[model samples]
Target: MRVTRSLTIKQMAMVSTVTLIIVSLFILLQLFHFVQQRRLDYAQQMESVALTIRQPLSEAVLKADIPLVERLLATLKLSGVIARADIVLPDNIHALHNEFILEKPVPALVSHLFELPVSIRIPLYSPERAMRGPLALLVLQADSARIYQFIRVTVATMLIAYLLLALMLTVAISWCINRLVIRPVRHLALALKTLAPEDLIAHQLPLLVGHRDDELGQLIMAYNHNQQTLGSIYNEMYCKASGFALPSLPNEALFLALIEQHSKSVENAAPLAVIVLRVETLQETHTLVTDDQRNILLITLVNRIRDCIDASCVLAQINHSDFALLITRDSHIFRTMRLARKMTRKLTQPVTLGQFQLHPETSMGISLHEKETPHAKELLNRASSAMMSAHYHGKNQINVFRTGNGDG
Candidate 1:
């Protein structure tokens, strides 16, 4: 058996994938925002520390206060903004916190998303020294090792939360769809399968319980109405019609019902092939062979013809020696013509009827369906006319009728 995919699985995958993409975009945006905010806060703190120490360091340097310069540099490092500082005023001095600890570092790709400033430089001057440009430059490099460690801890925790949220959302969405939609549709299908086609009035589909006044509930009501209509219409046609009662779609008696149904279709599938196939030899067998033998042969031939079609089509015994095949699901009539040839081959096979051994002769007529003749009755008449024309031409003949042509 071929495995058909369930609606739930499809819905789950589609909904989950879309949601994950959205969540990922949001997380990416949030990461950029977090980094931007951290950069702003770091800039403010570093500037404040640099300003407070700039004057004292300048004064210390002007008075040649070596001890004061050391104290100022130490304070700048301890203030916790700059990772490493460098003072350049002819004698370049550097101070770095070698004890800075980072618990976890963010990946290079994550850190590169935003172009955050790595370091800043501040110029130091003293008016008291009567120096116009006699000053030092204070360079501060950011403590990214610590900043990224903070980001990593936050992101790791949020990633787990996001994963859990996505899983829960997928489950919730799939469950809701199955309960609200798929389950109801499945129930409707099961109900339809149990319905008896011949006696549709007695097998009314029960309305969906929770979906009253909704679209699905309305659909169920319409289905029950259709069943009643079909049953009553079939009963009426069987009682009143004078001609041969068409067998069901599965049997010829229901052929009129299918015609009635298809007549109402605007497209009714495609430009169909309405065919009238006459087994001239099968009809001749009625006179030469026993009724039982003829019936057996007819049944066998019908089954073979049924095998040629895979999709839904109407096949019915329209006459004692004739059958009608309506290919309503085809894209073109070429496949129907191929099927006709195959059926012709089946008919030509020799049959042993007691003492008589004979090969059946067949005459087939095909009419192309068009928007001008949407009714199955009209299409059939055209094909039947064509079949009669084929019969006039002699045995084993085929004739095709164009939609608008008067002379087929």
Candidate 2:
């Protein structure tokens, strides 16, 4: 199986982000529950301590015993559960130990603002019915430092776990997705790169994926069928021709096919110009030369035409005496005219053929197709007519055929 390496990092990042969010929410919920539970437990412990010392605290306040009251308060503070303790008498007298007094009021205020202290006020009463009224009030404040520290530790532990879990999940999820989805797609793409009509017919292409009745399997089967059909059509068109040889340029069949294809497509609606170059003295030269010499002359003329025009222009040998050039409207009228004049001058120059030198007279006829035409045959006919008109005008002449023109 092909291993897909791309998109792994991106997929991992996406999965990690989602996992982190979920884990963070879960940890936050647990932290909130823990804080509330701690606060409730602290409140219960303070309430139980207040209840146990209620009678003693009430008697110390009734007797006006300062030392005894101080000792009772000291015991509550020493328990470590209470940060501060205060005694309030019925006469509106409030007393507290100096040891519990905050040295820096700012830190105490800040602590109170961040972590609320558990404050419990217990009312004391006498044993007699007539003394049912409260003797004193026991006020207890629980130290919140331990609770806040626990919360900090829990938060740090949760964050560490979150990081570890995210990393593990990213790796595991990326591996699974790469193996199941990305690997198959990559393999299919690699196989498609090697798929060609020729290779299909020869059975030379390799199957990168295993056979299955999935979408990918169906796609591969369809592609193979299409390749076979195209290969058969190509063989029928070019292979069945007489002598089974490739069509040479100026082959009317190939030229017509190109024109027909262009006509069917709107994007290729730009004007197409066909230029016919006729050698007036070719018939005379044919009788004076052998077949090899004729071939040499044709080759020389073809080369000269090629030198005059850009590579984009198509050059074709129409017959023994005529050659055809197909150019686009973008080639400009002036450029085409200059090229035609240049071809006439070059072909007329003296060329050494065996022991004799011959000067051939050539004429060019151009016909532009500005509007849609039924077929390429019509364009060829018009170009040929223009050439005949140039012949009438005399040797080395160039004529452009226009609609309603005498030549057209």
TM-score of each model, in listed order? 0.50, 0.47
lDDT of each: 0.73, 0.73
* Candidate 2: tens digits of C-alpha lDDT, residues 51-112: 88788878877777889878877777656667788887778688644245342233565366
Model 2's TM-score against the true structure: 0.47
Summarize candidate 1's per-residue lDDT along 98-158 as a digit string, tens digits. Answer: 3223324457765676553357778777757577775777776667766776577768876
Cα lDDT of candidate 1 equals 0.73
Please give the clash total of every predicted structure, in order.
Answer: 10, 0
lDDT (C-alpha) at residue 328 in model 2 = 56
RMSD of 2: 17.9
Top candidate (TM-score): 1
- Of candidate 2, the 10-residue stretch with the lowest lDDT total is 239-248
Clashing pairs in model 1?
246-252, 246-253, 247-251, 247-252, 247-253, 247-254, 248-251, 248-252, 248-253, 248-254
